[model samples]
Target: MTEALGTRTITAAVLVIGDEILSGRTKDKNVGHIAERLTEIGVDLREVRVVPDVEEEIVAALNGLRHRYTYVFTTGGIGPTHDDITADSVAKAFGVSIDVDPRARAMLLEYIAEKDLNEARLRMARIPAGADLIVNEVSKAPGFKIGNVIVMAGVPRIMHAMLEAVLPTLDTGPKMLSETILANAKEGDIAGPLREIAERFPGVSIGSYPFLSETGPNTNLVVRSRDPELLAKAAREVADMVAARQPAA
Candidate 1:
């Protein structure tokens, strides 16, 4: 097992594949959830790409993301439907064979009667060779892990459950520490200066989250870093910046 290096950065990318998402039939919530979860476990979400269910597109996206990031997660397109070609595309990307895994078959067998586990349902079991199974607790159908890519369900509930099952097995680096300062400023007003602070704190990730309410305009400046001291220092600087911009009462 490879241990995560100390102070070494780990990053991940998400590939959301489905015609449904691209057509606006379904909104993608997995990317945000996965990003938060990965950040909690010390992996930075570097990029996200939403692609249609085209095989060539899926193959190209997966190949690119898998090589660029420590982990690549793909949600949507692993189902038994006709448009579900994620498995085949992933296999092609790795130059591997797509086959039914006996382990996955056994797990499915536990839920459904032997006679009922027919061809279509068995389609879910067609995992890429040498891939590890990511257990699906809600349904017996399993997600798969090939190399550094994890193929999970499209349904947010199921995808979240599958991630819970898989996260423990991954090597996580030092969890990020974050500090926030809320200021009565618009995002547009602070975006430029905040970006400068972010550049200054090279090790920290600075984000400006703006919210509107009856209370007035508010922006939360969050600074995240693997080093607690660095995060605190950056947070103070951001607070000062925001305070300076606030109109004196």
Candidate 2:
């Protein structure tokens, strides 16, 4: 669901597609990068899903995410191989036809020689109908945007370039403000009061993350709100709770 503060929340989801990722052969590095980049631009990354190279699975996940969120960013399966089926799957998901676009071919020709652009390599030029290309500066193979779904490359560098190229075209909301209070106490120690504080500030989001410190287990209380005043107020209350929970010297 899109989070609401004062303005309408712009939400997005990430769909990671690759057999290698699901089989644990390739570790995902795009989700976190996408999350951070979107957050920086005031877009909330609501959900993330990883699916294999199967077309039906990708189509299902793409349709599901496209209808649910404002935007769906997909990584992988757009390469120059039989398994690179993201473009076709996205076309199927949108009920559109897929074909090699002259525009995409031109982009590829910037790097790949025309004679050397074999059948497999030409696969990179396939794009869904009515979709805009997301330029890939690193590699000439372009990503594409169809409806709300953005199909990007799986390689971290290429994906990063595509995301950068697409970010300017997206709508963003007010940035989410956050403050962290190092509550040098266990999560259990502050759960009760934290709940009370959270209830008091309906607009603020309170999260308690537990970690092991040199002494023992401790909790980090993060207070988040779009409004600076509200964030400061919630942070003060959280700090007070942490101080109260602290042992006297």
Candidate 3:
């Protein structure tokens, strides 16, 4: 089912595809970068899943995410090697034909000579039918956009570049505003009041992060809301509550 855009609260998901990532051989640096970038643009990244190089897993994950979110960004598995099966898996998910696209081939020719465009190298040019190309600045190999899924390289530098190129074209909503209050009390001590505050402001989201400081147990209460006025109001209430909880000096 196709969803109508132009609505507030745009959401997205990230699908990390690689056997190396699943095995912990390669540390993932793309998810955090993508999450931060999306948050800045008001696109909420709601979910992230790391799948291996298996075709069925990729296809299943892609289908599920694409249907549930506004956009699905996938990283890795679109290279020349045999295990780089993202393109093929995406094609299967979308039920589209996979072939060496002339435009993608042309993009490759700019970097590689015709004589050197071997079958292995040409594998990068195999794009799904009816998908638009995402220009990669760091490398000539282009990522692609099919339906709501945007596929990019797994490398940190290249993924970052492709994300920059693609983000501007995506739909966005009002950026979520946040304010943090330091609760000089333990999370257990503040749970009741925090729950009350959270219940009071259904529009605002309150997150309690507990950490140990030299001073002793402390909790950071983060309040987030799309509306600035609501956010401020909730933050003020939270601050007041925390102040009341603290002992007088």
lDDT of 1 by residue, 46-88 (tens): 8999999999999999988999989999999888778889999
When sorted by lDDT, best at the front, the candidate numbers are 3, 2, 1
**Model 3 worst lDDT window (10 residues):** 1-10
lDDT of 2: 0.92
- TM-score of structure candidate 3: 0.93
The residue-by-residue lDDT of candidate 2 on 24-133, one tens digit each, is: 99999999999999989999999999999998999899888899999999999999888888899999999999899999999999999989999999999999999999
Candidate 3: which pairs clash? none
Q: What is the C-alpha lDDT of each candidate?
A: 0.87, 0.92, 0.93
Identify the superior model by lDDT, candidate 2 or candidate 3: 3
What is the per-residue lDDT of model 3 for residues 1-249, given as tens digits with 9 covering 90 to 100? 112233577899999999998789999999999999999998999999999999999999999999999999999998999999999999999999999999999989888899999999999999999999998878789999999999999999999989999999999988877899999889999999899999998888999999989989899999988878888999999999998977889
Clash pairs of candidate 1? none
Give each model's clash number.
0, 0, 0
Would you estimate the TM-scores of all the predictions? 0.89, 0.95, 0.93
Using lDDT as the measure, the top candidate is 3
